[model samples]
Target: MKFDQKSSDKLFSKAKELIPGGIFGHYKYAVRNEGPKFFSKAKDAYFWDVDGNKFIDLICGWGPMILGYNNPVIDKAAQEQYSLGNTVSVASPVMIELAETLVDTVEIAEWALFGKNGGDSTQLAVMISRQETGKDKVLKIDGGYHGANGWMQREGSPGTIDSDSSEVISIPWNNIEEFDSAISTFENEIACFISSPFHHPTSEDNVLPKKGYWEHIQKVCNEKNIIIIVDDVRTGFRIDLAGSNKAFNFSPDLVCLGKAIANGYPISALVGKNYLKEAANKVYFSGTQFFNSAPMAAAIATINELKNIDATSLMNHHGNDLKNKMISMAKSFDVDLRVTGVPSMPYFRIENDDKELHFKWVDNCLAKGIYMTSYHNHFLSAVHRESEIDLIVSLASKAFEEIIEV
Candidate 1:
């Protein structure tokens, strides 16, 4: 059966009248004919659109639904906290509890700060680094995306001025020589180097850190007193409960975590070593909803569930299986496909740079009831079972057929 997006189309028309650019930001309708713009409901590993077209979700709510949509344990925790009260005139006990849990769990965390989004956490990390070092320059990965904020925006994004990135230095990922050269050029003026544990740049194939690459970077940072910030907003708990720093066996001065941390709740954390506590205290990072108890409760529950179930291992196993199946299927059809990044955060691409073919193949998959994006890495969740994996492979096989036919 084909997708019926009549209801979705009507909503989009109304949304265009009310909302700017029909839809704004990263989720804007880029593809000519994509899936529904609105979803009616979501359960474990699946969601239904307004027109009632069901899909086996592979995007996992853009990396926030690690435990899966409408997770009972996480929802119950949030609901219980909501019953008590979501926000108050002062901070809630759950906030302290969550902070303590984070410090205990994350390797480099001796103190924790809360925020409402990944952007907030990342911006705060930079602020703390600058404050601590009394420096102006901040280094970043060339193609990395920290957030939509001015300093983090790509070179050509609209409304971003030169001054926004004047002090921000961009370097290639997993390249020690380039990193060293940037450090030498900036010297003591550089305050911090911020990056994701792995390179998952938008619209490009993801990349893993080379052997000894992170070690060299960490060594330089330690020797030169440069603060290191790991922006694990998209790969935090999904990769390892403690943080990707622990999984990768390197330490960062500060870590920004969001997305999967609270299982789709609006929460982000800036965790750092005890040495930066004074600098963190000096920063003025605050939001009304940042102190909300519901998301903190959800995060606590999510972390506990992940630990109990060894969710990372499960997801990695399933993700590897999915990757293998896709590669094998693509070979059978003589379609060029390359899969990269970590197992839990697999990124695939059609070898040819034909944008139209990529879009058509992705659209075909959407039509076939599998939700995957061509522009970003696909996420896996603890709730994605073997049956779902099998279905994803079968759907991808069909999608490959469409690619070859095109």
Candidate 2:
């Protein structure tokens, strides 16, 4: 059964008075769904809305919930933390323990600071970089998503970045010369280089760094005393307990960690080396809600679970399997499907001029109890099972057949 739009619309109408557009941001408005069908509950890999229409949840809370929604162990740990009087005037032992766990597990994380969102952590990283390097300009990839903060979203375009904040420079990804020129051109004025290794443009191509690209970049940053900040908001625990940093075999001065850090709970961290952490000390970086205990407690449990299961490898395997299956099936349907991404994450696209057909396929999948936003950037969860894989592939096969007919 489908969710009743009338009731959902009622809730949206009521919500709009207090919350803008009846939700958090513009993306919520972009959702073509008639109304927000609130989730009633979720299990390992499936969830139902208030109207009780179940979905496979391919987006997986936008790349968190790696261990799955309402995970038993995580819930039990959260409950235990609550039973003990969640927060106190003093710090919880779990906080330091979690920090220690991060530093110990992540090779580059000599020091760490926790926060409530990736935006916070990333902005903090920026603050630390500026302090450490005494530079105001930050170089970022043109389309990279660091967060939604002013500095993060401020672009070279009009109404984005103004002359006062003219230090911000946006460049294309994977172009070594462009980066080198920016560094040499800006020199001491450039403080940091923040970027994501994987490019998730609308094309769904999971391009990797060219051979030795990272190593060469690292050398350049070292030469110029420019701090490197890697935004692993989407890749953090999903890529590894450490992040894409470890996967690429190159470490950054400061790392923005988020998303899967707390198994879908709102927790993020800025892990940096000595100088960077000291730089943060000089800057004013504090949030009242950042001290909230629930997400921290959840993070502790999530880290422990990650250690116990070597979950990154598990997620990688499942993602690879699902991607390969879909690729094979799309080929059988005579569709040029380019499936790409690391094992932990995967994306797909139809190589054709008919971009509208992409949305049609997405809608068809949704009609069949599959929840995918678009084929451009989809992900896998650790909770996804072989049975679910078979079902998704089977449904995708059917969708492709129908999509290619016209």
Candidate 3:
């Protein structure tokens, strides 16, 4: 299943001349030394590259395409909006409907604010939290990727604020003790504790909140009058229509969402209660592109489709089958590979390998037909049928045997 490499090599050489990393987004050269394979077209749960090689899509543009690639319903909605003049002079009527849908669907979302990307909504949520709480610092989960923007990247990127800065404190996830200590240490300065519902990039397993973790944190934050911001950029909509909070039995004061919204369209939402939303009015929260109607309409249509088809169940079924089969096959090979996280989404990594070693295994999988942007994370969408999951598990089994036997 090795794909033809000539066209992708040429494309990468040309792209490298224009772009510093020969790519435009995250995990560009991190997984593959040459760069990820370039796609020519995608339909349903599969994608074809410039070399005309087809493969099952496990990434789905980093989990945004939950309804699969080029879904007709969402595509038709976007096309109709374009026909009626995309981005109108006056406010789009669709925005009102989208807000209503969000308020009605999500558990704690009373008011919705729109943004173009995940980073925008996260920063906006942080701003609103700060404004409402009048605090300078925010407590963040270590290794949880919200987005590549100010409030997120500033803590760990090449040149930005230090991790222990006065404005933000990055603590490890699943460590309630550390979370409590950080809050006690920076109580007055801390505006909120913003975290991804599922711990990503650092830990392998989802390890969801350790039973009443959120409840305890909620109690502490409420007692201290601190806001809790759930960064649901990756987990929202896909985990549930209301996001992972629905499963966890916890509600945050504010939530930032993207990726799964609009079924891959460029839209992010900052949802909060009316009381907290009023703080947004006091601040200068504004974006020209945020009010675009196409993405908002697409989001409404996307949610409607998700509700109609029970997408969460479909996704979870596919992901769980893939995980179970892959792990079972890996065990047959006498390898210690483990799969972790929610059934709808899972992360994979070799137990006894360093970053480079694990990436080599992943690169091997890529050469065989699999595509995962990160070393550990792979997203499953509703488009991935049972056959595709079986195929992936079979390939992964062989790949694991080859990697571990050596």
Candidate 4:
């Protein structure tokens, strides 16, 4: 049966009249022409659209719902904090507790700072980098998404002056020679080198670092006295409890974490070495909601649960199972399918001469009560059990069959 989205369509019409572009940024409803625009509610591993069409969510709210939507433990923690008072004139003790938890949990994190979103942490990291090193240039990987802030935004766009990114340098990922050249070109002026642990560029097949790639980068950054910043906003706890830097076996000077940190709560953290504390104090990083204790309480609960349950390992196992099944099913149908990136965050690339084949396959999956996206990596939640994985594989087999029949 086809999924109904009549209510979603009506909402979209109203939204387009009221809000510019009908929705904001990455979650834009227009990205998938066949996807629903409004969801009535979401629970563990699933959500219902406005028309009451149920779907097994593979996107995981774009990477924040690591444990699952409306997780009871996390919500209860947040609710308890809310009852105590979410905001106060002075920062709550939960902030200190969460910081302490991160320092103890994340490798190389001796200090932590809170923010409301990924962009907040990233932008603050940039400021801290410059202030601490007294340098003007910052290096980044080409096509890497740090955030939507001025300096971190794409090189050229409206509303951002040339000076905003004038000191930033970009080089291709996984190429040590190019990285060396960029560093040499910028020399002593460079302050920090920031990048995601893996190459998960939008709409492209995700790329893993080659053997020794991260170790080499770390060596060079250390030799050059450049601070290394790992933007683990999308891959933090999902990769490992200690952060993706630990998963990749590389140490970073600073790490930006968000999304899954609080299990869908609006919170982010910039964890760094102790040396940067002075610079962090000098930088003006403040938000009214940044001190809200609810998300901090949720983060504490999430981190405790993650440690007890080994959630990362479970997610990776399930994700790998799904990847293997999808690949086998595609082979059975004689279709070319490639799965890339870490198991926890897998991107499926369809090799076909037909340009629309990917979209058609995703539409087929959506019709079959599965919510998958063609343009981004799929996330696996801890709640996706073996049975759900089996069901997803079966649905994917049908999606592959539909693609072949077309």
Candidate 5:
């Protein structure tokens, strides 16, 4: 069942001379010597490697391929806008269209701003919070990732200095006591409390907030005037299209979105209430590509298409089916497979405290064409069919069998 990775390995070898680490950032870390390194083509819920090995993409381009790869609707939107001219001297009217669409769709969105990546949205959210509150410190959850912003990154990560995260206070997820402790200690110094709607750290079981957790935090932050910022970059569309915060029944001042927003188009959005509109305009955050028309057009089309398909509910159904089937299959093999987070974005873990065995199982799955990761959570797209769920469970059972045999 192992797929050949010769073509991928050779291409990576050539890339190493021209590109640092053949790939850089988080992507370089996902490299498996025996796994496909580069893809030649991708379609609905699946992809083909350069060597022509096919796989059911559980990672879903790490989250952006929510509708699926090569979705004709999304592609046509981007292509048509490109044909009209992608980047021009002025901002495109499509930007307005995209903003209007987000405002209409997102529950708390009274205004929307564009960025090229999730990091951009997160950084912009932080900046806007700081600008409005005039507070310099940020409060965040431990192990919560909001992109490569130095303040948000783990302290002392290579080029980042100690001061980059000096004003940041990290708290445990779902721990109300510590959250209060932080608020008491920081007092008026904290500008915003930014975190994903749920706790989804790498290499660990995902944790949801305890009951009344958001309600308590919301009340406290309101009293203290600390802006509530939901870094929904990773869990945006998959959880609830109105915004992840809505699912938890808590309101946030600002919501950061990306990954699945445009169905693989390069766009991220920062949506907020009208009260912050002035501060948002005051804080400057822009890039040359931020004004690109194609992504905006694609975003508009993607949002409309998601509504047309009820994509959130569809993905939830697909992910839940796959998770339940796999967990049941694992039990038959006497494996303790735990799936956490939301129904649409499931974080799978082998709960035996044996990391190597877990990795081996994931490697086995990868070799058998179920492209999943050992460390991070996997994304399920609306396009993942019922047949694919059965296939995934079957492949995962084989992986469990292999581990058992070993």
Candidate 6:
């Protein structure tokens, strides 16, 4: 099942001459030597590499291809908008339409602002919180990623100064005591408490929020006057249409959304409650391409399509089925397989903390055209229905068989 990488290798060689890292995106951190370097095309729940090898795309372009690749509905919307106007000198009405759609969908979203990436929305949300609270510090769960902003990154990441994270406090996830301690230490200095709805850090078993975790945090933040910002960028439309906070049964003042918002279009959103609307209006954040209208059109269509199909429940059905099938197949082979996070976005791991064995298993799966990763969680989409799951799990079983034979 080894894919021919001659085409991929040639591209990498050329890319290295022009690109500093040759492969700088998140994929570089996850791909294997045998993995696909460049994709020729992608369809529903699958993509083809340059060598004409096709693989079931469980990663879904790192959580953007929620409906499918080159989907007619989304593509038609973007194309229609492109013909009308793309990056004009002014904003488009489609932006308002998309915002209205989000306001109608997300529970806490009364108003919405647009951006180009998850980082843009997150950075803007933090600024708005700071502006509203007149505070200088931010509190977040340790290991919770909010894109590539310097303050959102760890303290000593490359090209970031120690002062980059000077006012940022990192506390443990699912630990109310840690949150309380940070709040106590920071007191009135903290502006916002931001984190994903759950703990889905790469390379670790995804941990759900313990009982009453969000409730306690919400209560404390309410009492302390700290703004609650839920970074729902990755888990946006997958968990619940009204927002991931609805699934967790908590309320956030600001919600950051991206990734699958436009079904693979380059757009992000920061939606918030009425109280933060004035602060958001006062804050200044803009990008050269932020006013692009095509992605906004795509986002409107994507949201409508998700609602029409009840995509969240569809994906959950398929993801839960895949989880069950894989676990059952692994049992037959005496392999330990653990799947975590939401049913629609599952992280797979081999038990006993065996990193080497887990990587080997993932490699085997990738070679056989069932795209999987050992570190990050994989996304399921509305199109990944029963047929796709059958193929994915069947190939995964073969991967297990090969590993056992070896």
Considering every candidate listed, which one attains the maximal lDDT? 6
Write one digit per residue (lDDT tens) for candidate 3, span 125-211: 888988998888878887777777655774555756664344778888788899889988885888888988868764455556788
For all candidates in order, the CA lDDT equals 0.89, 0.77, 0.80, 0.88, 0.92, 0.92
Q: Candidate 3 — which pairs collide?
A: none
Decreasing TM-score order of the candidates: 6, 5, 4, 1, 3, 2
Predicted candidate 6 versus true structure: per-residue lDDT over 41-61, tens digit per residue:
999889999988899999999
- Candidate 5 achieves a global lDDT of 0.92
What's the distance in Å from true for residue 72, model 2? 1.3
**Per-residue alpha-carbon lDDT of candidate 1 for residues 1-406, written as tens digits (9 for 90 to 100):** 3578898888888988999877787778343355778889999999999999998999898899999999999999999999999988988999999999998889889999999999999999999999999999999999998998899997767899988999999998988889999999988999999999999998888988888888888999998889999999999987888889777789999999999999999999999999999999998989878889999999999988999899999999999999898888878977777888898888878887677876777788888888888889989999998999999889877876765753
Q: Residues 307-380, candidate 4, lDDT per residue (tens digit)?
A: 88889999999999988988888888887888999988899878888859877887888888888888888899
Q: Which ten residues in a row have the lowest lDDT in candidate 2?
A: 29-38
* Candidate 1 Cα deviation (angstroms), residue 279: 0.9
Better of 1 and 5 by TM-score: 5
- The C-alpha TM-scores of every prediction are 0.97, 0.93, 0.94, 0.97, 0.98, 0.98
Question: Which runs of model 3 end up more than 4 angstroms from their true locations?
Answer: 34-36, 154-156, 161-165, 202-206, 353-357, 401-406
Model 5, residue 38: what's the lDDT? 96
Better TM-score candidate (3, 5): 5
Clashes of each: 0, 0, 0, 0, 0, 0
Ranking the candidates on lDDT from highest down gives 6, 5, 1, 4, 3, 2
lDDT of 2: 0.77
Question: How much is 88 displaced in model 2, in angstroms?
Answer: 3.2
Tell me the deviation in Å of residue 301 in model 4.
0.4
Question: Residues 286-351, candidate 2, lDDT per residue (tens digit)?
Answer: 776666566778888888898788788888887788888888887787777777777667776677
How does residue 16 of candidate 2 score in lDDT? 81
lDDT of 1 at 332: 90
State residue 85's C-alpha deviation in candidate 5, in Å: 1.3
